[model samples]
Target chain A: MRIPVGTAVAAGSIVALAIVPPITEALREPFYLGLCLRLMILAIAAISLNLILGFGNMVSFGHAAYMGIGAYVVGIGAFHAVEDGIDWLANGFLHVPLAIAASSLAALVIGAISIRTRGVYFIMITLAFGQMLYFVGVGLEVYGADDGLSLYMRSDFGDVLDINDNTRFYYLVLALLLATLYGTKRLVASRFGLVIRGARSNERRLAAIGIPVYRYKLVAFTVAGAICGVAGVLLANRTDFVSPDMMHWTRSGDLIIMVVLGGMGTLFGPLYGAAVLVLVEEFLSGVTEHWQIVFGPLLVLVAVYARGGIAGALRALERRRG
Target chain B: MGEPILRLRGLTKRFGGLTATDSVTLDVVEGEVHAVIGPNGAGKTTLVGQISGEIRPDRGRILFAGQSITRGPVHARALLGIARSFQITSVFLDFTVAANVALAVQAHAGHSFRFWRDAASDDALIEPAAEYLGLVGLSDRTDDVAATLSHGERRQLEIAMALATAPRLLLLDEPTAGMGGDESARMIDLLRSFKGRFTILLVEHDMDAVFALADRITVLDSGRILVSGPPDDIRADPAVRQAYLGDGDT
Candidate 1:
């Protein structure tokens, strides 16, 4: 029996990511490890966004707000730990839960209002909420505000793990990414996932069939926000920095680009998108300063010609070969 | 006849200056095939919309099983055993026919927050979904995407979905709307087979279907009931013929 193209792609990527640490050490190039870590973290964010965007048909434009909220939780926790002598606040246990809860709360409020709207209206409402959070981050003078803040140190997990060791941190991030991918795969196939997909397909019919679509959508939005917050927490730890810019609208656009470029509805599409987009940006920037001039047209061409993005193109090729 | 399962009292809906449904009151008896027939723009769809909770009546009460559901949202009414099919054939076109019916069954099974087990493979949902599809004679087409089915098959799928809800009142909006002669006969036979097992409120422009299936017929003209009675009485009534049936176009 032959493996599906998607499975092969996912497996190949996972193996590549798993060996990156050793490969970097062998080649004496640590920069690629850092880049891969960042890619995986953003892939987590994209996956979270896809849960609502691709599955639930909610095109949220403010998803980065949750990531920013997660980053700030860590940044603020570390700030208090150093300046106010509140050391427990710096614990990873506190940081992760706090980030999840804070982002979930924000999502609940935002989703409560925004989920009622559809089409471009929903998009605008989410964008507005995101902008509001961005400005609030800018006004947070106690933290670094516009300039941003540096973490006092990596989150403390006691003797269980040391995130200061880049390899250990890389593995931890990879584990989270793998968990997210697996969890999302299960989620989309589960009853709740079917409800979300049903809503995406025909919300009226779902409601007519006795599914309270608004409640499900709100739950999905909150779940997505919470997961994205975790991604933000990992991002802050990886970079040792947190700022309003992390949750800026453009960052949210970048996440959408990743989802669209990979495959909107497929399980591993966002991972492919995140990897390809980052690599393309890195390679293009090296070639010229005006990289967006080349990138803009390329994105448009994908949008116009390849409606399913990279995953779709790969599936088409597989079908042809078969 | 059994006591009224659904009562619409003074139902009124206006779009801007146009009164779509005006102070219309009607009762749908339990286990009866109640047909609401009218000319174009005569408010049959609007009246159905009010009962199904898609449209809020400007002034009226919708009583289902002796409980007021005028202000209840669409899904709440659905849970209370009301299901409706659209005239334009609205369904989850991307999903399999079985999956579409399964989703309807899953809606009533419990809260769909089970986020682990694969829904596609669940025997609990798929079994009942297959039963409903078989009832509608769509057993063979269960695995096909809904969009791949013919128009009549989609209508059958729609009925299957509505039936899977185990609804107390099935609201069918022009189930034979665009059907050819053979397909329409099959739809009629399907509805004929469901005559007593399901309480249906049918909105139709097809005179033959209305006459053949309706135990009671309510004729609407200019957003108000022209008359309502047994099929023979509706057939004999001159006012209904002049207002709707005599148009010759139908």
Candidate 2:
């Protein structure tokens, strides 16, 4: 009946985070809530990437494309509603679900073609598709094109939930993060998860045993894309802006780095990774403008020394204690 | 016994100037251990590859369970009850022994689109996996990581995984290629236990195991079938003796 230490830590962190909104408000520094919101959004995005990269071994360098697509869906929906005075995009329930659906559809199309190729080719193809979408974003003349698009107001929940209140939004973000973490945990341990992990280990063997591995990998890729799309909805609400820069390949690389740093293949590793990477970026940028130069070496050191990332290190410590 | 479970017709594969499998043909009857034996260049592995649908023949039709599956994909062939064990051990090294077998069971059970329940504890997958592991004498090592097993044990584990798929026909490629004398004998006994229950296509370098297990033997030479008949006839054939079994041996 021993609980995995990583799971315990993740649960504890979520509890602490649930209290941070109130504590920060009491201290009159409500800005900290904003930072925590960033952490939650990034964690959701990273967790989605981890579903494929860590478990299925699909090294997609275009994951952020889904996030961008999701954000743009909300942006475009708002654009139609606010500018054109339409009710279709104005509906919260319809638009949010539609955004996720569109993202999953994009992943299915991209993954079908990309999953056929292996190794470096898969990475390059995903990156190429992501860049294609980024260019598309840049080319949207009606939506501010290269500059970006801004929402006049947060998504309308229509009495269901209020996105205007920072506290309510913070709680919504927290709830979604916990749900994603818990759902991903179940997903990676189920029958589907076993097949995906097996494909990563040995695709040929899995096929020999009667598993249609390509179809399974494609499903996983689509699911991950849909989850990241939901994160994008939160991200758009947080910043109230959508841009091609959101889908840039470097953003995908950042998501990959977070998965790698958190100890991939562990359910809670992405959250740990997102927090560390996002917080460190904030901390170092505050100290000096040339934060990347300082941060770059630290990432290399972790990549070199942290064999399995933070969660792996924690597991080792727990073993030593036992 | 009424009809052959597996039939290969005019199977041919050419690698540039060299012919790997040249217009070869064979039949494997139901519920019989059929052994394919050859020297290093006889294309035994290549033949296994073509039948398993990993390698497509330039000109041929593979009939499995009385259907032409020449163009069928590898996994489609597997779903039609053709299970193959690799010459090189290929079980999931990172998974536990039970998990390795459970994956095989899961593949055959139904669509593995299940994403909620914990598969590791599923009685449907676990019970059958344990049974298959027991068949290969690996029931006690269920919880052990597959990579930690000895080389011979891994080979046994590979066979266990293949068996877990519940295939009507088993394609074993050099099942005892790297095993100690004790391990080899144990493998032979385990395979022999399934003799009449499964139609097995075996590729082996070990003549003793082959002679002991094979109901029929096909001797391949230079990418062609030199001789194929009952084990006694194969043993007595002078062509087989010169081509494969050297004169000094028997």
Candidate 3:
């Protein structure tokens, strides 16, 4: 198979990650595992946003709301189960599906209204929905309110899987990331994907050609939300906590930044973006407490120099070689 | 004429006090190139918009294939065999020419909700896409990015995409608006090739193309019809000459 250099780079990175637990253990650096896990989960979220923002051209600024909703599903389910001693509600297997379904339903309602509007109106409405959800989270009296709720135990995956173990959990997240990438690649090359991408370029033209572009956009929005929500379940497991701040507007901005910085439309771009963002945050914090002061300029450089982001830059280089 | 295949009755649209299309009534036979011609701001574009469902008329009824479609959505009208090309050369600039046509084909072929297969390689989509591209004489430019094509080629690609939908009526809004002399001629030749095979409602500023291709002509002046008849009749009518063709200028 003739794999593009970028795809190879992405696969190699995943393979390198597969062996990370041993290397980090040898170096006595357990923090690397947590960082890698965070990167994978955030990558999932970025990919979900990419489906709408990059492909469908629906600039939703409230994507993090779904992630927060997904994480909250786990937190609320676990809390209620623990409080009332309900087995089915507490099951991790059930929790993941429930979280995805809840997030998908939320996306359907929000997308139905949000997709009706375009450009800045779309962005504003999405941000409004996000803020509404954020306030709702803060208003929950039983769920620890602003302080957030902690999971008493990590999700149980039966006797075969122990999510508490770092190596196993890392592999699980990695596998899901790979599957998401493959599935998304297929999706974007499918008929549905063409309509989504076509709408991005000329929505009016698409409508004239007998395609109901809005309905396709709604479906894409829902799918992205469902995917991101799955990532939220993983996030709650990784951090063992859920809070309203997770779905704040700034968090949504970060997801947008990830999509743009990595390469908005390319499949593997989000993974690179998530890795770069998390690594930069880690490195900057290590060097100086006020990392944003240094980091803000770096982002501006990427914005100015990389018109198509990193993936676009790589394609340009490939074109030059030929 | 056994109920014109397409009919517009009392179509009226107003932007505040300014009327864009005022009580416009028209009809199109099953297989004839019915041309709409007028000067700038004569509401040709607005009339096309109302027909295509982009601009909802304040008062009107549109019947396509003998069914009232005044409130039909743009896509629904398109699916009912009415395809329109944009006046300002709208297209998917980033896609390849073939891909642009393929997307149009995919839109009408079946449910676009299929998410698992690679549509780019599906022969069901690609085969007809190639056929349509060839029909527009864009077979050579199939792999070229649409944005890289010349202004004339982009317009041709637009027509090809419209044709891929297999529409019964094609609404072309100034398909040769920005073309040079040679490009405009080529477009005329292309449209002529489809004569009598597809119903066309053409809005144009090129008097030569309108006269050459239109079996019948409708003249619009300030959002109202001045005349609608055969091309020779339009040329002879002194009122049309003074208002639109400019008094013996033709």
Candidate 4:
């Protein structure tokens, strides 16, 4: 049997990402490693958003809030670790779990209210909640407020893993990205995922068939938030900085664009989306400072011409080849 | 012939000054097809909405299987063996026809929180789904996407989905609404095949299908039941004729 184009591309990209650190080291350019790391981290966030936006048909505009929450959890924990002499708070084990728990809690509360509305109202309510989190970040006076906080050190994973090393951290992020992709694949194909997809397609029909669509959607929303929180943790470690800007509504917009650009419901779409967007932005900004002017029309053309984004275009090509 | 499977007592509903259903009281007997017939704006859809738990009555109580379920949510009512098809075709258009029915089967199977196993390959869902599709004469289209199906085929798929729920009472709103003559005849035959095997509360505009398939008919005018009886009695009733059947305006 012929391998699907999407699967081939996804597998090829994974192999390529696995060797990025070695190639960058040989070239003596660590910046490329950092860029790839950033790409993978954002890809994780985009994948989480796809759970709701692409599969569940929830257009959440405030997803960046969870990433903000995750980063802040680490930042605050490190702050307490250094200032208050609470060293255990610096543990990666503690910070990662706490971030997941906190972000899921926030998602639960936001999803409960937002899932009641649909279409533009859902978008606005999610945006409102996201902005609420952004301002809360700004109001945090002890945690460096709007200026942001710097981590004295990366998350302490003990001897089990060394996230402080650039090469080691890249692998860690890569592993997590693969796990998210695998877990999501299992999730969307599972009974619970079918409920989510079915609800997206026709909520009323699901209700009439005895499925409580609201509860299922809220769970999917929370799951997506928790996964995004993990991405946030990695992001904080990668940059050694945490700020309210992490969860700004514009950042959330960036995540949405990544999902749309990759392919909304496709498994490997977000990764491709993140790569293209980060690489294109990097390339365009290098050519001209006003890169957004060029980028804006480029995205519109993709949206109008390619209905399903990059992954969709690939599938179309494969179909034509057959 | 059997005790009431569904009872609506003093089912009143209003939208501002317009009373959509004015104290509409009705009973659906077990193992019978009871069709609700009315002219435009006579509140047929609203009545179905209240029975299926989509719309809350301003003042009323709905009982199912001799239990009070007046304020229960839609899914709750569905779990209690109530299922409905919409006036407009409603299905998971992106899913395969089998998958659409599989979702209905999955609903009645158990809690859907199992997030590890692949649902599409589960024979437990797919088998029952296929059986129901066959029952609706849609077995051939089981793997086809629901969106690709024609209008009448979607109506059949809707019935298959409702049947998969193993519901005790089926609420069918306009099942033959947009069908051609041959399609309507086929639908009537399908409903006729299900006459005694299931209890159906049908809201429809096709008088011929209603007359042909209804074991009992309730005629509504101005949100109130003008007359109700077997087909012969409904045909003979002058008020129903003047208000609905015989009226040239209909």
Candidate 5:
């Protein structure tokens, strides 16, 4: 099947990104490619969160725990697998899959408890749970005790998929990110997606029409968490290390900022948001150290003036042009 | 043709110092209009809430379609064929009028998990939604955003959505709460046309509409039923006349 129109544009952008080796020798560095990979991972994570907060109307503030748990799955798996001298499964492919599953299961338990309440209470409970996980993660002296753990070798998915090769891993991130955007678009427009949109619009009305809203929301949250687990596994691979800092509250804020900056409730918002956020952190900081002082209020102004965020602004421009 | 579609036995609710609904016992027979009327703050809305499974009672049982549904959640109560419209208009304002009704129909037509198909373009959802909109006289405004519709029109759309679910019992709170005189008259005509087709529990402030359409009347005041009877009897009863008509206001 064909990819969507917006995704076709993104596909072209990736082709341009692939040709960076000719333009600047510095652009071809593994360091720069690694940075782009990091952005893609965060975008994947933010898009997952959007399904719950934007469409489901369930604002979960503590989504970083899935990332942390996903990170630790690799850390702990590699530690035990290496110590036992079992070279068969402790590698990247086996470890990352285990990490994804662990993250999703943890999300299920966390979502079940958090979905009972709504509004601000839901946000707080989820944040509390994420913080609790972060504390536990930090307490793990077994995985270097707050200092973090380094991977001795990147997980190898046998012969075809070598994460250590920057080009191969970059392509991998690009494919997954594009696929996530496609999957999310299909979901929001689908029948289940309509239920999600309805719940966000007026949950009571949805219930009065005989649709089980709570279960639907829980399922959305779990699915969002499962998708986020993929981002976490990739983040661990990109870093070649795992840390409790991945679950920190500020990191969660960064994720929210991406979703908000891109736009909430609109498709392709996360892509624009992720690209803007990562580019700002990389480029703006180069000009001055106090870049956030400028960036902070700008973001605030964007939120205050552009309630629909950048997408709304662009749409406004399009309307003016036409 | 069948058992009472909805039954309430001593449904009671208290709001701390205030009791909203006290010992409300109601039965809505299949295929009839059962209207609840009273002055402002008379607990009519609370009774509707209790019956529709939004608010649980302190003590009592609610039966729907001849089965105990007291323990069921709101959607469960709805799936058993009871639907409700709000006092304030509650459509998704940003969506088109057709989309709002289609969402209700979508909830009933099939599982909403079909991700690839455009929900709006699906004829299965659109055709029935258009029919309901036409039934409510909103077909011309089908593509219009709900927020742009006139107030009375939104109220009509509210009813249109409630009906889209194909409910056996419809609980309507202030169905014409903000409508003009003409809108109120039109709503009564709509109710009259809908009578005996499906059961309805209407809570309205309009005395004339109530008297015009109620097959049976239940008068509530201070969370207690002042009286319950035929419209003619309730109209003449001194207690209801004094409590609702404000001694001489009617």
Candidate 6:
């Protein structure tokens, strides 16, 4: 129990991923590689939102907008770079950093406006902003409108680091996800984390105790946006495509579902939730075209039966036993 | 007193037709226990709210430590060493007693930007938190979940947590509200022991505790000051006796 939950989770994931590549390659299974990579990216996205919703008590419904912002970054960058023969520094890396910056900037503005209201209003406003982003993504002609754009080639990390190859791409995505997980763990545990948690527990108490709750929550929101932006980039790279689907409200719901399914507020829970979701998607889809009919009911069950999600329920059980 | 540590001048708050706090003015010297006593509907809690920045006043200025802090928000006021406890025992019930106090310690230990280290493990945050807990007689129950504590004990924990901020002016809003006679007396004794170390602004209805511990008693009726003086002077004031305490009674 003394062991940091974040570190333990990161270690377990790395060890599991290390065994996956060789096993998949020997079995001549290329699709499983994509599935695993997709899970990692989604998990990373879910965890970013978890920092805000779970710990900060900020239920942002527009979280998928960051992911969309990130995808568009790569998509737009690749289009300009490929067509105009722009340099790597100009066309490729340009979009990734810009995406994160845009998302952070957007979060600052949206957070400012949304945090002015409390309870249900906050959730509604965030979802509204996310819908706006989704519509905007659909309207963009440069990125193929509703069709989505694909990268003809991956972002060059230099001559040695081609993202076009599946195995190399998988490792790179893994590294970034781990880094994000580590960063989030550090950010939450810091003095800042304590403040954020205090604000979440009781904003009035925090204010009386000498903390600017609104400011701390806004900063945490921006951090979550930036983190989600990173996840978006990995997601776009893994799929080799970008679409307005990335910013859809349902996508935001998916993120929330993953967070709640794994366990809201628990750092490792998001990863587990993401992994379980992708596996369920694969298994369900293999059975029939309308797997969602089955998946939707299962989610309802999870929500109804487990309000605290898996981790909270497990903790309750442990306490009962002890 | 030379520059009362906290001074409230002409503070008023109106709710539609209801005057929650009428033009109320009060003062607390650097090391005096100034008690405000009033009936249930006399705007006692409202006065505490206006003074603590929870409810902004429609009019009037507040000065803390010789400087006007009328425009300061709750957090800013708290940072300037003003700490207030709730009349209804408010605490971070989900957090452990130590974690609850540690948050107050974290607020004052510079910025909370230090990441990658466990905040609970940091001696800087923990030691001060522990010291305050010990002061409030909560040292043994530091690890206990605050929600599980008895109501009176939770009140003590609130004081300990508030003290962790190293407040210059401690505002206690009915610290003995829900306590039994013995618990209430013990709480009063604890507050009595805290005299001379920090300024206290106590708003309570308990006549025994108020009269016994107060350096100066301020009586409020209909959101206005009925009278304010030393216990002997306040006790004999006929107007106070009529407005608050009926006929020869306290």
Name the best candidate (by DockQ): 1
Given candidate 1, what's the lDDT at residue B107? 95
Which pairs clash in model 2?
A: none
DockQ of all models, two decimals each: 0.94, 0.91, 0.92, 0.92, 0.73, 0.75
- For candidate 1 chain A, the 10 contiguous residues with the lowest summed lDDT are A2-11
Q: Number of the top candidate by TM-score?
A: 1
For residues A1-322, what per-residue lDDT tens digits would candidate 5 score against the true structure? Answer: 7454444545665675565434434655666766677888888899998888877877778887888887777767667767776676556667667776787788888888899898889989999988998899899998987888887656667787887876788778888987898899889887788888888888888888878887788888888888887888788888989999999887887888888898887676766787788889888899998889878998999888998877667666656655
Clashes (N, CA, C under 3 Å) per candidate: 0, 0, 0, 0, 4, 2
The Cα RMSD of model 3 versus the native structure comes to 1.5
* Fnat values, candidates in order: 0.97, 0.94, 0.97, 0.97, 0.81, 0.83
Docking class of 1: high
Q: What is the TM-score of chain A in candidate 2?
A: 0.97
Candidate 3 residue runs with Cα over 4 Å from true position: A1-4, B1-3, B247-250
Give candidate 2 misplaced runs (Cα > 4 Å).
Answer: A1-4, B247-250
Segments of candidate 4 deviating more than 4 angstroms: B248-250
lDDT of each: 0.94, 0.91, 0.90, 0.94, 0.82, 0.85
Worst 10 residues of 5 chain A by lDDT: A19-28
lDDT of 1 at B124: 99
RMSD of each: 1.0, 1.6, 1.5, 1.3, 2.8, 2.5
Q: Measured by C-alpha RMSD in angstroms, how accurate is candidate 1?
A: 1.0
DockQ of 6: 0.75
Give lDDT tens digits, candidate 1, residues A1-322. 9987767877999999999999999999999999999999999999999999988899999999999999999999988899999899889998999999999999999999999999999999999999999999999999988999999787888899899999999999999999999999999999999999999999999999999999999999999999999999999999999999998999999999999989898888899999988988999999998998998898899899998888888898789878
lDDT (Cα, 0-100) at A224 in candidate 3: 98
TM-score of 2: 0.97
lDDT of model 1 at residue A223?
98
Model 5's alpha-carbon lDDT is 0.82
TM-scores for all candidates?
0.99, 0.97, 0.97, 0.98, 0.94, 0.94
lDDT of 6 by residue, A119-140 (tens): 8999999999999999999999
Clash count for candidate 2 is: 0
**TM-score of candidate 5 relative to the true fold:** 0.94
